[model samples]
Target: MTQPAKRTKKDKIGSGLKQQSWILLAIVLLAALIDYIWYDAHWVIAKSAALGACLSYLSQAIFAGFVFWHTGYRARRHIVRQMYRGQMVKWLLTVFGFALIFITIQPLSAPALFIGFMVMQISHSWMLWRIG
Candidate 1:
C-alpha cells in the first residue's frame, strides 16, 4: 500500500493544531470568566494569564510539530534526531516568547502568568504522557 502524501500529513497536523488551539482558548475563556466573577480578578490579570497559557501551549505544540514534521515509516534514528531538534527549538521559543510577552504586555500579573503557564504545561505533559 502507498504511504500517505507529505502534504496530507502536514495538513492533518495543521488541522489538529488548530483544533487544539480552539480547545485551549475555550478553556482559558471559561477560566477567565470564573476568575473575573468569582475571584474578582482584574481584566488585565485574566488577559495576562490567558496569554501565558497560550505561550506554554504554543511552545509545546511547536515541539510536537517538529517531532512529527516529516514521517510515515521512519527509522528509529531519524525519530530520535527529530526529537532532539524539537527539544532545542522548543526551549528557544519558550524563552523568547516569555521575554517578548513580558516586555510588551503592560499591567500584567506575574503570579497569575506563572500560574497559568505552570498549569497548562503540567496538564499538557500529563495528557501526552497518558496518550503516549
Candidate 2:
C-alpha cells in the first residue's frame, strides 16, 4: 500500500503565512477601493477621507498586534513574555496616535488624508512581500 505524503513544519508555516498575507492584502485593497469610490463620487469630503484613512491605519495596527501575539506565542511558547506585552502596548499606542492625527488633520486636508490611506495600503503590500 502507498502511504500519503506528510507535510513538514516549514511547509505548514509557509502556507499559513501566505494565506494570512493574502487576506491582509485583500483587506487593504478593499479599503482603498471603497475610499476611492467615495471620494470620486463626492459622497464624503476630504475630512471624511482622512477619517477613513485613520480607520484603516487603526485596522492595520490591530492586525499587527494580533500577528505579534501569535508569532510570539508560537516562537517562545510564553504568552506573558515581555516582548508580547510590549508589542501589545505599542500597537494600542500606534492606533491611538494615528487616530488622533487623522482627526486633527482631516479637516485641514481631506485629499491628503486619502493619500495617507493609499500610502498605508502600499506599505502593507510591501511588508507582505517581505514576510510572505
Best by TM-score: 1
What CA RMSD would you report for each candidate? Answer: 5.1, 9.2
Candidate 2, residue 109: the lDDT equals: 51
Off by over 4 Å in 2: 1-18, 41-79, 87-91, 103-132
Q: Which residue pairs clash within candidate 2?
A: 46-110
Candidate 1 — worst ten consecutive residues by lDDT sum? 5-14
Off by over 4 Å in 1: 1-23, 38-42, 72-74
lDDT scores of the candidates, listed in order: 0.75, 0.53
Best by lDDT: 1
Give the backbone clash total of model 2.
Answer: 1
TM-score of 1: 0.73
Structural similarity to truth (TM-score) of each candidate: 0.73, 0.33
lDDT of 1: 0.75
Tens-digit per-residue lDDT, 4-115, candidate 2:
5442244444454455455445544554577567757443444444454555555565555444554422455543464566567656765676667656753445565556
As a whole number from 0 to 100, the lDDT of residue 81 in candidate 1 is 88
